[model samples]
Target: MQTRTNTFIAITSLFIALGCNQHKESVEPKNGGATEKTIEPTNKVVLSSDIVWQKLNPARGDQSPQAGTIWGNRNGKVATGFLAKFTDGFSSPPHIHNVTYRAVVLKGTIHNDDPKAEHMWMTPGSFWTQPQGEAHITSAKGDENIAYVEIDHGPYLVKPTDKAFDNGERPINIDASNVVWLNYEKSEWLAKDSKAEISFLWKSHTDDALQGVFVKLPKRFNGKLHSTGNIFHAVVVQGGLDYTLPQTNEIKALDIGSYFTSSDRALHSIANTSDKETILYIRTNGSLNIDNK
Candidate 1:
């Protein structure tokens, strides 16, 4: 708790010294000439359309009769993306992942009823993880197709079953050691040492491009001074934070679920001002190495 308190005060001082101009920056495209535009996205609303299957991209990762891919690892480590489209009322047989599996639902509904008896229904924004040797079954319901993001830990996609669909009448038994949940309630606060081993469900690692990672910060904790890609932004998905600019030694009080972007070439840190934990989803578009800085 003392470390948390120190973190909060440190972030506050950084914010105050930063005044108000440290959170805004202009982003330039990698090839130069073109300027990047920022659009404040609004909440998603469900609507009805009769277009049937929409092939967003030709090639992604792997496509099967019941499963189709969207995007996957393009150039090995530099870029990666993968997605699957499940047909209506399609249920895949129980299968196992020989390698780690990371996936997120883009649309429709998917149920993964392993490790627990309860049926877990995932919507469009849901993300899930399946470790190697973990066996599970999946399916899509209703008239629409189920789309998802998949990132494999190995070179190829591995499954225990050749059939993609299986009826939910009988249960399939397999090893339950590495099974994990992607959707979890944020903790009150997370310390560096107390940080849990979170599963990388689906991560698209792209150099010089923006990547989003979900992180939880415990209450009353201050953050360390760090720099990544020359520019960075932190959005409070939940709770509030008292932020600090490391270089300027200024601080400011930000409310719950607010948005803050760092200034150009400004060293920065953050703290949790609320009693509850702070949850943040961050995206950065430049080199993340800060050793020289």
Candidate 2:
């Protein structure tokens, strides 16, 4: 891949380093005298402040929306998750992306559609997707507009409408009001008795078995989110949560655009101490076991 822009900003080291080291679990002795360091996976949190912000398209470069990566490299040829912040009243000219992507609104409102489409402002908690090579425009009109954008594979690029071509995948624009919500009892990932709600967003067409979901917590909810999978990416989309820090056990308030992740099997401690419910966008290939604290 000769594309330099997509590989430009990568914090591969940071994602592995941002973790909080909780107590290591079940030490297994190594065989044949190999050094035994089989520690259990630890939880990591990337607060809004910890994000390294950069331009989404350095080529377009004209005040392009600022992107803060949560995991993977937006400019690389691998899966990526990043937060894109748009200026108020900002709108892009008709363009197409080199790869498909999914997004969740975290702050303010956004309008993404074909040039001739009606203006449909997607507010917080809304979900949308733009297929690769599709011609479209993105607009932000809120005082502060932010969204969590993700791609399965990237060097996510911005090309002129001339590059548009359908790959047999259609676009989906779902506003917050149109989204369906299910209580915990109806979800396999949440505790049945909890007030938490969950919504399905998407599932991978690849063998990675990746999927996207939105989980909502009731006010002041305290619980542990146990994840058992090879990959997990969680982002704060609405309200806030008190997350335990990796280095120190200090509780940090994670607002919109903040992120956290886990590997293999790990438990993440979270508390929705706010008076309102908090919603999180989770990209994972595992099962979520919500346990009350």
Candidate 3:
């Protein structure tokens, strides 16, 4: 375990730090002829409803599934996170992508394995990885099939099976129930008194490798993902919560598929005030300290 003890440090940051805060506000000035103006920082947020869908394979045209990007650009050479939606009973012919990627099933069920492998359905919360140039077939079941896919860097492209070549990394398909977790008592981030848990999914191969992790919040749980990293990405993979930034109380729905990125030290307050648990999938190059409340 290469866990970085975040007494003060952790997760992986994204490929780029993207944010724009051009919000403007007007207010009455006591002794001014015109109202005073103020600018508000609209946190870097990308919602599913706002995502621009594109064909996963432009060449395949309508024959391909849809991809909705959350952060970065899959067509560009940079780390990216996006959603893949497949129609029910959808299955792809044998194919390979140019880059290795990590994926998490968010809705319905997905089966991603070798072309000749038997179907192994993975339900919501399941995690899987596809090595670069690995030949595989992706199949989906149920009416609403969606999964969160991420890449370390891209120009993500689908290629014919003959182009497949080993990158030395093997594929892993872990059912949700098979996930091993570290409870609050064992983790350094969560409050020892809280019932939250965390699970690490992957870590990049670079010296300052980014980490992909899942943090599960108990019902009504409130906390902050206090971290010093300048580049980070947090996506709601399960359930929902209110996300607020430092010096700002304007909380917004951090529901599934709604994500926010940051390029500076972040003190993001999150709360799962609902009755159900909420899970956040965070990627960063540094560690985090949870301010349990």
Q: Highest TM-score: give the candidate number.
A: 2
Q: Write the per-residue lDDT of candidate 2 for residues 1-293, one digit (tens) a residue.
A: 01121221242232222111110221112221101221454668888989988876676675678998889998789999988999888889999999999998888999888877877788998888888988889999878899999998989888999878889887777777766666654554555587887776676778535677788888989987766566889999889999985446778789888888877566677999879989999887766666577
Give, for candidate 3, the lowest lDDT window spanning 10 residues: 15-24
TM-score against native, each model: 0.37, 0.83, 0.82
lDDT (tens digit, per residue) of candidate 1 on 141-253: 75554443333333434456543333322222111122221222221112225432111211233342444444455676565323234334444434566665333445756
Q: Which runs in model 2 stand beyond 4 Å of their true positions?
A: 1-39, 57-62, 245-248
Ranking by TM-score: 2, 3, 1
Deviation (Å) of 240 in candidate 1: 28
lDDT of each: 0.40, 0.75, 0.72
Off by over 4 Å in 1: 1-79, 161-211, 214-293
Clashes, model 1:
28
Worst 10 residues of 2 by lDDT: 26-35
Ranked by TM-score, the better of candidates 2 and 3 is 2
10 residues in a row with least lDDT, candidate 1: 42-51
